[model samples]
Target: MIKDLFLSGKTAIVTGGGGGIGRAIALGLSHAGANVLVNDLGVSVSGDSEARNPADTVVEEIEAQGGRASANHGSVAEAKATEKMVEQALDTFGSIDIVINNAGIIRMGEFPQMSRSDWEAVLRVNLQGSFYLSRAAAPHFRAQAGGAYLHLTSASGLIGSTSQANYAASKLGIVGLSRAIALDLGQHGVRSNCLAPSSTSRMTELTDNARKHLMSPEKYEALKRMRAASAPERIVPLIAYLVSDRARGINGQVFGARGNEIYLYGQHRPVRMMHAAEGWTPAQADERLPAGLGAFATPLEVITDVFTWPPA
Candidate 1:
């Protein structure tokens, strides 16, 4: 099923396709019979400007395998650059059917110690970039009556994070964005979904701050095991599948992939309900709410706490 060519005749724009999971998804999508536009700024995971643009290398690899592909060296942080990406895809492939928001950067800081610039920088690329790409393609998608968006979010966004406040905020913001897009555009046959993937990539590398302050010995060891067991390739197939025609019925949901395991994230809903028939004052409200509802409150869990065992 993973090797099915269900995406034949589609065109996909894969941002951050230079390396890691982004590269893997681009290659996989192309092999599924889609024309791919591999876009990468060639900057490090930190989002610094660099001399090289690695998009071309991935394009070369796709071409070597007898696939149709092109390269774009634009930064997703800029709206105009993302617009140009859509233009390039349309010019080369005739139409854009899929947009993969895989380009993101992480800056480490605890809540109190986080700098404003660091927070804004991460959101600019990770959250706003997703907006730019999706917005740029939306008109075309509307005109064509169909399209798909696959945003690569993270467990840090869904669950609690370990001193990655900026990164977590951006990733969680993406979930909200995806839900909005799915609701606003689903009538037009457009679909939007989020993939919270675990992988051994540059973003997953443990930071020194986390090493020193954020973790106990147990958590530190657990994180190391997670990074070692999850590979970027294992997360790619689900991403590719989410943006293909085969997944047309699925929309507005968050899914996860780690190792060979895939699972759905529970969306928010009320777990308990309490009614005060007498319309109690503030004093009585406190007495009834906590005693009745506190027991049902969800525990604060990190990715590791929920996934106690290593994935196969």
Candidate 2:
């Protein structure tokens, strides 16, 4: 059982722990013996309107299961709010050992038609939000000499997804942020990593009736197949393991969870290096570069194109 994994005497702050994937991770962390501070803004997936406190419900569920948890309704988009989140976790659980930068909002739009407001909104919650919480936790982790950071990434950016350039950009930026954090804080014994989850979610906008008319029948049906086979619960095991002592040696990595399959993702590298020993004019370079690099050029493929087989 994942709950049997070792995480005793530790505290975790799960941002956006109100619902969906965030809620699942929070519960998983609690079951694994970590005191969880459930932080959420209680806003809709689109980052609009607050309702009743979503964090409280998760806290109640955790308590009912004989686990320790606290409710924190703070937006990670603000630095001050995230700072308060770290303080809340310390006050509630004593010492922080895990930080899950899972709180996020999506504003999907294609590049040409994407709005400035929409782009900013997506970046604020997905990229800046992760930065804020991680930044606030840095000093504490440094002092303690041991901490783990996991930020949620997405195929939308890691690979590609149609009509979601704004969302993709933010998610991809998170990959960079996680790597930088891992590098700077490794000396302090803080580990930072990223998880790209393939699961069904309330944010699955392809189900919208209006959008259904915009996509081809085959394309829409394909997306449905990919999401249907994957569940939010399937992601819990990997997360539980990553935050536990068992994964102490694992740091500065990107991982993925899809149904029963877990993946270690590869980072960017030079596929083929071209050193122009002597500089050439634009016309000369254009003539030779494409000829030399054409075979190695990456195809413009979406996530679905690559993960053609659904996880069983």
Query: Which parts of model 2 have CA positions greater than 4 angstroms off?
Result: 205-216
Candidate 1 deviant stretches above 4 angstroms: 1-3, 207-209, 216-218, 278-280
Residue by residue across 28-51, what tens digits does model 2's lDDT show? Answer: 888888899999899888898777
TM-score of each: 0.94, 0.95
Which numbered prediction scores highest in lDDT against the true structure? Answer: 1
Q: What would the per-residue lDDT of candidate 1 be over residues 1-312, giving only the tens digit for each residue?
A: 345787899999999999888999899999889999999989887788767688898999999988999999999999999999999999999999999999998888768998999999999999999999999999999999999999999888799767788889899999999999999999999999999888887767645335445567776677677777778877877876888777899999999988888999988888888877877799988778888988899888876678777677
Best by TM-score: 2
Deviation from native of the Cα of residue 184 in model 2, angstroms: 0.7
- lDDT for model 1, please: 0.88
The Cα local distance difference test for each model comes to 0.88, 0.86
Candidate 2 to truth, TM:
0.95
